[model samples]
Target: MSALLVRHEANRLGRDIAVGDIHGHFTRLRAALDRARFDPAVDRLFSVGDLVDRGPESEQVLDWLALPWFHAVRGNHEDIAIRYAKGNPVDQTSYIANGGAWFVTQPLARRPVYAEAFARLPLAREIETPAGPVGIVHADSPVRDWSRLVWSLRLWRAARDRAMWSRDRLQGENADGVAGLRALVVGHTPVEDPVVLGNVHHIDTGGWMQDGRFTLLDLATLQAIPPMG
Candidate 1:
Protein backbone atom coordinates (compact mmCIF):
# COMPACT_ATOMS: atom_id res chain seq x y z
CA MET A 1 0.00 0.00 0.00
CA SER A 2 1.21 3.51 -0.81
CA ALA A 3 0.13 6.85 0.60
CA LEU A 4 -2.69 8.34 -1.42
CA LEU A 5 -2.61 11.79 0.10
CA VAL A 6 -1.21 14.67 -1.96
CA ARG A 7 -0.13 17.79 -0.14
CA HIS A 8 -0.79 20.95 -2.10
CA GLU A 9 1.68 23.62 -1.13
CA ALA A 10 0.08 26.62 0.54
CA ASN A 11 -1.22 29.19 -1.85
CA ARG A 12 -0.51 32.73 -0.67
CA LEU A 13 -2.46 34.52 -3.40
CA GLY A 14 -5.74 34.09 -1.50
CA ARG A 15 -7.14 33.10 -4.89
CA ASP A 16 -7.67 29.38 -4.65
CA ILE A 17 -11.01 28.36 -6.13
CA ALA A 18 -12.82 25.03 -5.95
CA VAL A 19 -15.31 23.77 -8.48
CA GLY A 20 -17.80 20.97 -8.02
CA ASP A 21 -18.29 17.82 -10.10
CA ILE A 22 -17.37 18.85 -13.64
CA HIS A 23 -18.91 15.79 -15.30
CA GLY A 24 -17.33 16.87 -18.61
CA HIS A 25 -18.85 20.36 -18.58
CA PHE A 26 -15.62 22.12 -19.56
CA THR A 27 -17.21 25.02 -21.35
CA ARG A 28 -19.40 25.80 -18.39
CA LEU A 29 -16.42 25.52 -16.08
CA ARG A 30 -14.47 27.93 -18.25
CA ALA A 31 -17.41 30.31 -18.25
CA ALA A 32 -17.59 30.19 -14.48
CA LEU A 33 -13.87 30.85 -14.27
CA ASP A 34 -14.09 33.71 -16.72
CA ARG A 35 -17.00 35.22 -14.82
CA ALA A 36 -14.94 34.92 -11.69
CA ARG A 37 -11.88 36.47 -13.44
CA PHE A 38 -9.84 33.39 -12.71
CA ASP A 39 -6.08 33.98 -12.93
CA PRO A 40 -4.33 30.70 -13.46
CA ALA A 41 -0.92 32.09 -12.63
CA VAL A 42 -1.84 32.70 -9.01
CA ASP A 43 -5.19 31.09 -8.45
CA ARG A 44 -5.48 27.32 -8.37
CA LEU A 45 -8.51 25.19 -9.13
CA PHE A 46 -9.15 22.33 -6.79
CA SER A 47 -11.67 20.36 -8.78
CA VAL A 48 -13.97 18.10 -6.76
CA GLY A 49 -13.35 15.52 -9.53
CA ASP A 50 -15.79 13.72 -11.85
CA LEU A 51 -13.96 15.58 -14.61
CA VAL A 52 -15.55 13.38 -17.27
CA ASP A 53 -18.78 11.59 -18.21
CA ARG A 54 -22.37 12.89 -18.61
CA GLY A 55 -21.66 15.82 -20.92
CA PRO A 56 -20.68 16.66 -24.51
CA GLU A 57 -17.06 17.55 -23.70
CA SER A 58 -16.11 14.54 -21.63
CA GLU A 59 -13.15 13.67 -23.83
CA GLN A 60 -12.00 17.28 -23.95
CA VAL A 61 -11.64 17.54 -20.21
CA LEU A 62 -9.14 14.69 -20.32
CA ASP A 63 -6.81 16.99 -22.22
CA TRP A 64 -6.51 19.17 -19.15
CA LEU A 65 -4.99 16.55 -16.88
CA ALA A 66 -1.50 17.92 -17.54
CA LEU A 67 -2.21 21.53 -16.70
CA PRO A 68 -0.44 22.69 -13.57
CA TRP A 69 -3.16 24.87 -12.11
CA PHE A 70 -5.80 22.18 -11.93
CA HIS A 71 -6.00 19.76 -9.02
CA ALA A 72 -8.53 17.00 -8.55
CA VAL A 73 -9.60 14.24 -6.22
CA ARG A 74 -10.73 10.82 -7.32
CA GLY A 75 -14.50 10.86 -7.83
CA ASN A 76 -16.79 7.84 -8.13
CA HIS A 77 -17.22 8.53 -11.84
CA GLU A 78 -13.48 8.34 -12.34
CA ASP A 79 -13.48 5.10 -10.34
CA ILE A 80 -16.11 3.67 -12.65
CA ALA A 81 -14.22 4.84 -15.73
CA ILE A 82 -10.99 3.22 -14.54
CA ARG A 83 -12.67 -0.07 -13.73
CA TYR A 84 -14.39 -0.20 -17.09
CA ALA A 85 -11.17 0.62 -18.92
CA LYS A 86 -9.51 -2.33 -17.21
CA GLY A 87 -11.86 -4.85 -18.86
CA ASN A 88 -14.22 -5.30 -15.94
CA PRO A 89 -17.45 -6.41 -17.59
CA VAL A 90 -19.58 -5.60 -14.56
CA ASP A 91 -17.97 -2.19 -14.23
CA GLN A 92 -18.42 -1.62 -17.95
CA THR A 93 -22.14 -2.19 -17.53
CA SER A 94 -22.28 0.14 -14.57
CA TYR A 95 -20.24 2.85 -16.30
CA ILE A 96 -22.25 2.80 -19.48
CA ALA A 97 -25.51 2.92 -17.54
CA ASN A 98 -24.26 5.86 -15.51
CA GLY A 99 -23.71 8.44 -18.26
CA GLY A 100 -20.68 6.77 -19.79
CA ALA A 101 -22.21 6.04 -23.20
CA TRP A 102 -19.73 8.35 -24.91
CA PHE A 103 -16.87 6.59 -23.18
CA VAL A 104 -17.99 3.27 -24.60
CA THR A 105 -18.13 4.83 -28.06
CA GLN A 106 -14.45 5.73 -28.02
CA PRO A 107 -11.75 3.64 -29.65
CA LEU A 108 -10.49 0.93 -27.30
CA ALA A 109 -6.88 1.88 -28.03
CA ARG A 110 -7.39 5.29 -26.38
CA ARG A 111 -8.88 3.85 -23.21
CA PRO A 112 -5.61 2.82 -21.62
CA VAL A 113 -4.20 6.35 -21.55
CA TYR A 114 -7.31 7.57 -19.78
CA ALA A 115 -7.05 4.72 -17.31
CA GLU A 116 -3.44 5.65 -16.58
CA ALA A 117 -4.47 9.23 -15.87
CA PHE A 118 -7.21 8.12 -13.48
CA ALA A 119 -4.83 5.80 -11.71
CA ARG A 120 -2.55 8.75 -10.97
CA LEU A 121 -5.22 10.93 -9.41
CA PRO A 122 -4.97 11.35 -5.69
CA LEU A 123 -7.92 10.08 -3.69
CA ALA A 124 -7.65 13.01 -1.27
CA ARG A 125 -5.73 16.26 -0.98
CA GLU A 126 -4.87 18.58 1.89
CA ILE A 127 -3.95 22.12 0.98
CA GLU A 128 -2.65 24.83 3.20
CA THR A 129 -4.70 27.88 2.41
CA PRO A 130 -4.75 31.38 3.84
CA ALA A 131 -7.36 30.23 6.32
CA GLY A 132 -5.89 26.84 7.20
CA PRO A 133 -5.53 23.37 5.88
CA VAL A 134 -8.50 22.54 3.62
CA GLY A 135 -9.18 18.92 2.77
CA ILE A 136 -10.62 17.87 -0.57
CA VAL A 137 -12.21 14.47 -1.12
CA HIS A 138 -14.48 13.47 -4.02
CA ALA A 139 -17.34 12.08 -2.04
CA ASP A 140 -16.98 11.40 1.66
CA SER A 141 -14.27 10.68 4.09
CA PRO A 142 -15.56 7.58 5.83
CA VAL A 143 -12.93 7.74 8.53
CA ARG A 144 -13.03 10.61 11.00
CA ASP A 145 -9.41 10.20 11.91
CA TRP A 146 -7.02 11.94 9.55
CA SER A 147 -4.26 9.44 10.18
CA ARG A 148 -6.58 6.54 9.56
CA LEU A 149 -7.90 8.12 6.40
CA VAL A 150 -4.33 8.45 5.14
CA TRP A 151 -3.80 4.80 5.97
CA SER A 152 -6.93 3.76 4.14
CA LEU A 153 -5.96 5.81 1.08
CA ARG A 154 -2.69 3.88 0.78
CA LEU A 155 -4.60 0.77 -0.17
CA TRP A 156 -6.14 1.27 -3.64
CA ARG A 157 -9.30 -0.66 -2.79
CA ALA A 158 -9.97 1.28 0.41
CA ALA A 159 -9.39 4.60 -1.28
CA ARG A 160 -11.69 3.69 -4.17
CA ASP A 161 -14.46 2.37 -1.92
CA ARG A 162 -14.38 5.04 0.77
CA ALA A 163 -12.99 8.24 -0.71
CA MET A 164 -14.48 7.93 -4.16
CA TRP A 165 -17.81 6.22 -3.48
CA SER A 166 -18.97 6.55 0.13
CA ARG A 167 -21.46 9.21 1.15
CA ASP A 168 -21.44 8.39 4.85
CA ARG A 169 -19.40 11.46 5.76
CA LEU A 170 -22.24 13.78 4.83
CA GLN A 171 -24.08 12.59 7.93
CA GLY A 172 -21.16 13.58 10.13
CA GLU A 173 -20.63 17.16 9.00
CA ASN A 174 -20.99 19.99 11.46
CA ALA A 175 -19.44 23.35 12.44
CA ASP A 176 -16.62 21.46 14.07
CA GLY A 177 -15.30 20.24 10.71
CA VAL A 178 -14.24 16.71 9.77
CA ALA A 179 -10.82 15.25 10.53
CA GLY A 180 -9.99 18.52 12.33
CA LEU A 181 -9.36 20.33 9.07
CA ARG A 182 -10.51 23.92 8.70
CA ALA A 183 -12.79 22.70 5.94
CA LEU A 184 -13.65 19.58 3.98
CA VAL A 185 -14.92 20.01 0.39
CA VAL A 186 -16.80 17.24 -1.37
CA GLY A 187 -18.87 16.67 -4.55
CA HIS A 188 -20.04 13.08 -5.37
CA THR A 189 -23.54 14.06 -4.21
CA PRO A 190 -25.13 17.04 -5.87
CA VAL A 191 -26.83 19.86 -4.05
CA GLU A 192 -28.85 22.76 -5.41
CA ASP A 193 -26.86 25.13 -3.28
CA PRO A 194 -23.53 24.98 -1.62
CA VAL A 195 -24.32 23.90 1.90
CA VAL A 196 -22.05 23.51 4.85
CA LEU A 197 -22.80 20.83 7.37
CA GLY A 198 -20.56 21.71 10.25
CA ASN A 199 -17.30 22.40 8.35
CA VAL A 200 -17.92 20.02 5.46
CA HIS A 201 -19.19 21.62 2.28
CA HIS A 202 -21.01 20.03 -0.67
CA ILE A 203 -20.66 22.22 -3.76
CA ASP A 204 -21.90 20.00 -6.57
CA THR A 205 -24.84 21.82 -8.16
CA GLY A 206 -25.55 19.09 -10.73
CA GLY A 207 -24.02 20.63 -13.84
CA TRP A 208 -25.10 17.60 -15.89
CA MET A 209 -28.77 18.03 -15.06
CA GLN A 210 -30.99 19.90 -17.49
CA ASP A 211 -31.92 22.51 -14.92
CA GLY A 212 -28.62 22.64 -13.11
CA ARG A 213 -25.23 24.38 -13.41
CA PHE A 214 -21.74 24.12 -12.01
CA THR A 215 -20.78 25.85 -8.73
CA LEU A 216 -17.41 27.44 -8.26
CA LEU A 217 -16.24 28.51 -4.82
CA ASP A 218 -13.69 31.21 -4.13
CA LEU A 219 -12.19 29.63 -1.09
CA ALA A 220 -10.43 32.80 -0.07
CA THR A 221 -13.70 34.57 0.56
CA LEU A 222 -15.86 31.51 1.13
CA GLN A 223 -18.16 32.79 -1.59
CA ALA A 224 -19.54 30.72 -4.48
CA ILE A 225 -21.03 31.88 -7.75
CA PRO A 226 -24.74 31.45 -8.29
CA PRO A 227 -25.63 28.78 -10.84
CA MET A 228 -25.91 30.03 -14.39
CA GLY A 229 -28.94 29.62 -16.63
Candidate 2:
Protein backbone atom coordinates (compact mmCIF):
# COMPACT_ATOMS: atom_id res chain seq x y z
CA MET A 1 0.00 0.00 0.00
CA SER A 2 1.14 3.53 -0.73
CA ALA A 3 0.03 4.64 2.73
CA LEU A 4 1.36 2.85 5.78
CA LEU A 5 0.23 1.95 9.31
CA VAL A 6 2.66 1.18 12.12
CA ARG A 7 2.26 -0.16 15.66
CA HIS A 8 4.58 0.54 18.55
CA GLU A 9 4.97 -1.63 21.61
CA ALA A 10 4.28 -0.18 25.05
CA ASN A 11 7.19 1.71 26.58
CA ARG A 12 8.05 -0.53 29.48
CA LEU A 13 11.21 1.32 30.42
CA GLY A 14 9.91 4.91 30.56
CA ARG A 15 7.35 7.45 29.43
CA ASP A 16 5.83 7.70 25.93
CA ILE A 17 5.24 11.40 25.41
CA ALA A 18 3.26 12.84 22.51
CA VAL A 19 3.91 16.34 21.17
CA GLY A 20 1.94 18.49 18.77
CA ASP A 21 2.88 19.61 15.27
CA ILE A 22 6.43 20.98 15.25
CA HIS A 23 6.20 23.05 12.06
CA GLY A 24 10.00 23.40 12.00
CA HIS A 25 10.40 24.87 15.47
CA PHE A 26 13.19 22.55 16.55
CA THR A 27 14.56 25.03 19.07
CA ARG A 28 11.21 25.37 20.81
CA LEU A 29 10.81 21.61 20.77
CA ARG A 30 14.20 21.13 22.40
CA ALA A 31 13.38 23.67 25.08
CA ALA A 32 10.07 21.98 25.81
CA LEU A 33 11.82 18.63 26.03
CA ASP A 34 14.24 20.07 28.54
CA ARG A 35 11.37 21.42 30.62
CA ALA A 36 9.82 17.97 30.63
CA ARG A 37 13.21 16.51 31.57
CA PHE A 38 12.86 14.04 28.72
CA ASP A 39 15.55 11.41 28.74
CA PRO A 40 16.38 9.77 25.45
CA ALA A 41 17.97 6.92 27.41
CA VAL A 42 14.44 5.93 28.50
CA ASP A 43 11.65 8.31 27.45
CA ARG A 44 10.32 8.28 23.88
CA LEU A 45 8.88 11.27 22.03
CA PHE A 46 6.15 11.03 19.41
CA SER A 47 5.17 13.82 17.04
CA VAL A 48 1.83 14.48 15.38
CA GLY A 49 3.76 15.65 12.28
CA ASP A 50 4.35 18.88 10.35
CA LEU A 51 7.99 18.62 11.40
CA VAL A 52 8.94 21.24 8.79
CA ASP A 53 7.63 24.58 7.52
CA ARG A 54 6.55 27.95 9.07
CA GLY A 55 9.65 28.28 11.31
CA PRO A 56 13.23 29.29 10.51
CA GLU A 57 14.68 25.88 11.33
CA SER A 58 12.80 24.07 8.57
CA GLU A 59 16.13 22.85 7.28
CA GLN A 60 16.89 21.00 10.51
CA VAL A 61 14.00 18.53 10.06
CA LEU A 62 16.27 15.74 8.90
CA ASP A 63 18.50 16.03 11.94
CA TRP A 64 15.52 15.66 14.28
CA LEU A 65 14.07 12.82 12.23
CA ALA A 66 17.31 10.89 12.54
CA LEU A 67 17.09 10.84 16.33
CA PRO A 68 16.26 7.31 17.49
CA TRP A 69 13.81 8.50 20.12
CA PHE A 70 11.70 10.57 17.74
CA HIS A 71 8.71 9.14 15.87
CA ALA A 72 6.23 11.02 13.67
CA VAL A 73 3.28 10.73 11.30
CA ARG A 74 3.02 12.49 7.93
CA GLY A 75 1.55 15.98 8.07
CA ASN A 76 -0.12 17.76 5.13
CA HIS A 77 2.87 20.08 4.80
CA GLU A 78 5.10 17.07 4.36
CA ASP A 79 2.73 15.85 1.66
CA ILE A 80 3.25 19.08 -0.26
CA ALA A 81 7.03 18.66 -0.11
CA ILE A 82 6.78 15.05 -1.13
CA ARG A 83 4.56 15.77 -4.14
CA TYR A 84 6.85 18.55 -5.34
CA ALA A 85 10.00 16.47 -4.95
CA LYS A 86 8.44 13.51 -6.75
CA GLY A 87 7.30 15.68 -9.72
CA ASN A 88 3.67 15.26 -8.77
CA PRO A 89 1.14 18.06 -9.34
CA VAL A 90 1.23 20.73 -6.58
CA ASP A 91 0.31 24.37 -6.26
CA GLN A 92 3.55 26.30 -5.88
CA THR A 93 1.81 29.51 -4.83
CA SER A 94 -0.21 27.81 -2.12
CA TYR A 95 2.81 25.93 -0.86
CA ILE A 96 4.88 29.11 -0.57
CA ALA A 97 2.08 31.05 1.05
CA ASN A 98 1.71 28.44 3.75
CA GLY A 99 5.25 28.66 5.20
CA GLY A 100 6.80 26.46 2.53
CA ALA A 101 9.04 29.11 0.99
CA TRP A 102 12.02 27.61 2.75
CA PHE A 103 11.44 24.30 1.02
CA VAL A 104 11.20 25.93 -2.38
CA THR A 105 14.55 27.61 -1.69
CA GLN A 106 16.28 24.34 -0.88
CA PRO A 107 18.93 22.96 -3.26
CA LEU A 108 17.55 20.75 -6.02
CA ALA A 109 19.73 17.84 -4.91
CA ARG A 110 18.55 18.16 -1.29
CA ARG A 111 14.84 18.55 -2.02
CA PRO A 112 14.31 14.87 -2.70
CA VAL A 113 16.05 13.98 0.55
CA TYR A 114 13.31 15.67 2.57
CA ALA A 115 10.66 13.95 0.52
CA GLU A 116 12.36 10.59 1.00
CA ALA A 117 12.49 10.97 4.74
CA PHE A 118 8.93 12.24 5.12
CA ALA A 119 7.60 9.64 2.74
CA ARG A 120 8.91 7.00 5.09
CA LEU A 121 6.65 8.24 7.90
CA PRO A 122 3.48 6.29 8.42
CA LEU A 123 0.07 7.88 7.96
CA ALA A 124 -1.27 6.35 11.19
CA ARG A 125 0.42 4.95 14.27
CA GLU A 126 -1.07 2.74 16.98
CA ILE A 127 1.05 2.92 20.09
CA GLU A 128 0.43 0.57 22.97
CA THR A 129 0.42 2.35 26.30
CA PRO A 130 -0.06 1.09 29.83
CA ALA A 131 -3.58 2.47 29.71
CA GLY A 132 -4.45 1.25 26.19
CA PRO A 133 -3.73 1.79 22.52
CA VAL A 134 -3.23 5.44 21.57
CA GLY A 135 -3.63 6.39 17.95
CA ILE A 136 -1.70 9.24 16.37
CA VAL A 137 -2.75 10.89 13.14
CA HIS A 138 -1.94 14.27 11.68
CA ALA A 139 -5.53 15.37 11.23
CA ASP A 140 -8.52 13.15 12.13
CA SER A 141 -9.30 9.52 12.40
CA PRO A 142 -10.88 8.16 9.24
CA VAL A 143 -12.75 5.34 10.89
CA ARG A 144 -14.90 5.31 14.00
CA ASP A 145 -13.33 2.03 15.09
CA TRP A 146 -9.62 2.00 15.63
CA SER A 147 -9.28 -1.73 15.21
CA ARG A 148 -10.12 -1.50 11.50
CA LEU A 149 -7.94 1.57 10.93
CA VAL A 150 -4.94 -0.29 9.62
CA TRP A 151 -6.74 -2.20 6.89
CA SER A 152 -9.06 0.70 6.03
CA LEU A 153 -6.13 3.03 5.55
CA ARG A 154 -4.27 0.43 3.55
CA LEU A 155 -7.15 -0.54 1.32
CA TRP A 156 -8.95 2.75 0.81
CA ARG A 157 -7.47 5.95 -0.58
CA ALA A 158 -10.32 7.98 0.94
CA ALA A 159 -9.52 6.61 4.39
CA ARG A 160 -5.85 7.51 4.00
CA ASP A 161 -6.70 11.03 2.82
CA ARG A 162 -9.06 11.62 5.72
CA ALA A 163 -6.48 10.38 8.18
CA MET A 164 -4.13 13.20 7.17
CA TRP A 165 -6.54 15.96 6.10
CA SER A 166 -10.03 15.69 7.57
CA ARG A 167 -11.31 18.01 10.30
CA ASP A 168 -14.97 17.02 10.42
CA ARG A 169 -14.82 15.82 13.98
CA LEU A 170 -13.56 19.15 15.25
CA GLN A 171 -15.87 21.33 13.16
CA GLY A 172 -18.99 19.31 13.82
CA GLU A 173 -20.88 18.65 17.03
CA ASN A 174 -20.18 14.98 17.18
CA ALA A 175 -19.90 13.95 20.79
CA ASP A 176 -19.10 10.35 20.00
CA GLY A 177 -15.53 9.15 20.21
CA VAL A 178 -13.69 6.58 18.20
CA ALA A 179 -14.01 3.09 19.61
CA GLY A 180 -11.22 0.68 20.59
CA LEU A 181 -8.52 3.26 21.17
CA ARG A 182 -8.04 4.74 24.61
CA ALA A 183 -7.28 8.08 22.99
CA LEU A 184 -6.67 9.48 19.53
CA VAL A 185 -4.33 12.47 19.39
CA VAL A 186 -4.21 14.81 16.38
CA GLY A 187 -2.32 18.06 15.58
CA HIS A 188 -3.15 19.64 12.22
CA THR A 189 -5.67 22.21 13.47
CA PRO A 190 -4.29 24.63 16.04
CA VAL A 191 -6.17 25.67 19.16
CA GLU A 192 -5.32 28.10 21.94
CA ASP A 193 -5.51 25.20 24.35
CA PRO A 194 -5.77 21.45 23.97
CA VAL A 195 -9.36 20.38 23.31
CA VAL A 196 -10.85 16.99 23.82
CA LEU A 197 -13.81 15.93 21.69
CA GLY A 198 -14.82 12.58 23.10
CA ASN A 199 -11.86 10.20 22.80
CA VAL A 200 -9.98 12.36 20.28
CA HIS A 201 -7.62 14.94 21.76
CA HIS A 202 -6.52 17.96 19.74
CA ILE A 203 -3.08 19.14 20.94
CA ASP A 204 -1.79 21.47 18.25
CA THR A 205 -1.34 24.48 20.53
CA GLY A 206 0.30 26.47 17.71
CA GLY A 207 3.89 25.90 18.82
CA TRP A 208 5.07 27.36 15.52
CA MET A 209 3.23 30.63 16.08
CA GLN A 210 4.81 33.59 17.83
CA ASP A 211 2.67 33.37 20.97
CA GLY A 212 1.95 29.65 21.14
CA ARG A 213 3.59 27.16 23.46
CA PHE A 214 4.43 23.58 22.54
CA THR A 215 2.52 20.96 24.54
CA LEU A 216 4.12 17.82 25.83
CA LEU A 217 1.44 15.27 26.70
CA ASP A 218 1.95 12.19 28.80
CA LEU A 219 0.55 9.44 26.61
CA ALA A 220 -0.22 7.00 29.37
CA THR A 221 -2.04 9.47 31.57
CA LEU A 222 -3.55 11.64 28.77
CA GLN A 223 -2.37 14.71 30.65
CA ALA A 224 -0.38 17.62 29.26
CA ILE A 225 2.81 18.57 31.00
CA PRO A 226 2.61 22.22 32.04
CA PRO A 227 4.49 24.68 29.84
CA MET A 228 7.76 25.93 31.23
CA GLY A 229 7.45 29.16 33.20
Model 1 per-residue lDDT tens digits across residues 88-160: 7645566776789887887999888787788788888888777877888898776676667776665557655
Instruction: Tell me the tens digit of each residue's lDDT in model 2 across 23-49.
Output: 889999999999888999999999999
Model 1 ranges off by over 4 Å:
1-3, 91-93, 155-159, 171-176, 225-229
* Residue 222 lDDT (model 2): 97
Error of 1 at 10 (Å): 1.4
**In model 1, what lDDT does residue 115 have?**
76
Could you tell me every candidate's TM-score relative to the true structure?
0.90, 0.96
The lDDT values for all models are 0.79, 0.90
How displaced is residue 163 in candidate 2, in Å?
Answer: 0.9
